[model samples]
Target: MIRGIRGAVTVTENHAEDMIQETKRLIETMAEKNQIAPEDIASVFISITNDLNATFPAKALRLIDGWKYVPVMCMPEIDVPGGLEKCIRVMMTVNTSLGQKDVNHIYLNDAIQLRPDLMKEE
Candidate 1:
């Protein structure tokens, strides 16, 4: 079955390194939380806020060893009024045995406000 995992993270700056690090953080957490292997991913779609233009989030994923074969797309997020800035969001479609309800969505840092219902209490 195909399952979609969603995640988002906030970046402190618009630098390429910061974008790469935060994007990696968010993707790693999403994979860990969902127990998803890179080979199991069908496609990955990432979007960055308008204010973050230093780099494409998909570029970071390409640097990963296993992610080279995965289809990754990057786009700019809609410039909504009052939307969070310096944010990178991901929607990864994975071929998994888990049911949709069992999938975990991750929202870290200020991005947590994007999906309060999916955020678990630690």
Candidate 2:
């Protein structure tokens, strides 16, 4: 079976280093929480708020040890009237035996406000 894991993170600024680090952190957390392997990932879709133009978040995936071949695409998020800023969202599709309900969704930094209900208290 294939499953989609959703994740979001916010960068303090629009710097390229911040974008790369935060995106990598978000993806790593998502994979760790869901026990996903790079080889099992089908593809990764990323969207960043219009305010973020420093760099492409997909660059983070390529820097991962085994994710060089994982298909990844990046685009700009819809700019709503009062949408969140400097936020990066990710949707990772992977081959897994886990059920939909068992999948874990990750939200970090200021992006946690995007999905408080899905977050489990630590």
Candidate 3:
């Protein structure tokens, strides 16, 4: 069986390097917390807010991880009322034995407000 974990990241710059580095950091954090091996990732979809257009966040992760076979795509998030800008959202489906309660979803930076109850407060 498998489960999905959702995460969001805020990029400091629109450069491919920044997007990739931040995404890499976020994914590493999520996987570590949930005990999810990179090989367990079934697929990953990332969406960046409309404000960012310089690079695709997905490219950053795939390049960094060398997970060329893992299905990854990046799209622009539609601008909506009260939506956060410069945000990169990731939805990863993983084939794992972990139960739902054990899965850890991440919400970072301004995106933390999107899921206050689940956000890890420090």
Candidate 4:
């Protein structure tokens, strides 16, 4: 079966280093929390808020040891009124045996507020 894992993170500024670091952190956490192997990932779609345009988050994925071959795409998020700023969101599609309800969706930093209901007590 195939499933999509959602995740988001916030950066302090629009610096390329910060964007790359935060994106890597978010992706690693999502994979770790869900026990997802790099080879299991079918594709990853990342979107950053209009306020953040320093670099492409997909660059971080290529830096990962086993993720060089994984497909990834990055784009700008829709600019909505009152929307979260400096936020990077990701939707990773993976081949897994876990059911939809069992998948873990990660929200880090200020992005946690974007999905309070889905946040698990840590």
Candidate 5:
């Protein structure tokens, strides 16, 4: 069966390095938390807030081992009033035995505010 994992992270700046680093961190966290393997991933969709255009978030995945074969697409997130700034979000579809309810969603930094209900108290 296929399951989806969602994650988001905030970038401190619009620079390419910052975007790359933050996205790398987010993806790495998701992969680690869910035990996602490259062969299990179907595709990844990445969206960035309008304020962040310095680089595509998907580029960071290419730097990771075994992610080169995963299909990735990137787009601009819809700009809404009062939306969080400098945020990048990802939705990865993967073939997993885990049920949807078992999937772990990750949100880091200021982006955590975007999904309080999914976050567990730590």
Candidate 6:
């Protein structure tokens, strides 16, 4: 069966380079924790908050994940009435035999603010 994993992270500042680095770091950490295989990756979708207009987060993943075969798409996040800023969210599906219980979801940096409960123990 296929499993879905999600992770979110934010740039330290508003810098494009920082966003790229943080996004790559969070994905790598999640992938390692979940033991993702390149061949098992179905695809990845990423969204950047309306405030961010720099490099796409998916570019960093393509450059760092070493999974040139997997599909990745990036887009600007919608500006909801009340929403987070300078945030990048990722959703990925992997072709895995493991169940959802075995998946690891990550929330890093300021993005953790979006999930205070998850960060309380960190």
Steric clash count of candidate 6? 0
Better of 3 and 6 by TM-score: 3
lDDT of 3 by residue, 1-122 (tens): 87999899887667777777888888778787787776888999899888888877777666545466778888878889788878899999998888886678998777777777776544
Any idea what lDDT model 3 has? 0.80
User: Per-residue CA lDDT of candidate 2, range 42-112, in tens?
Assistant: 99999999999988999999888989899999998999988888999999999999889888899999998
Per-residue lDDT tens digits of candidate 4, residues 97-120? 988888889999999999887776
Error of 2 at 119 (Å): 0.9
Pairs of residues clashing in candidate 2: none
> Which consecutive 10 residues in model 1 have the weakest lDDT in total?
56-65
Model 6, 1-122: lDDT tens per residue? 78888889877567778888888898887788778877888999999998887777777777664688878999888889678778999988988777776667788877777765544232
User: Which of the two, 1 or 4, has more TM-score?
Assistant: 4
Candidates' C-alpha lDDT: 0.89, 0.93, 0.80, 0.93, 0.91, 0.80
Instruction: Sum up the clashes in candidate 4.
Output: 0
TM-score of each: 0.94, 0.97, 0.87, 0.97, 0.96, 0.87
Q: What is the lDDT of residue 46 in candidate 4?
A: 99
Model 4 misplaced regions, further than 4 Å: none
Better of 1 and 6 by TM-score: 1
Ranking by TM-score: 4, 2, 5, 1, 3, 6
lDDT of 1 by residue, 1-122 (tens): 99899999998888999899888888888888888889999999999999999877788887776777889999999999999988999999999998887888999899999999887655
Off by over 4 Å in 2: none
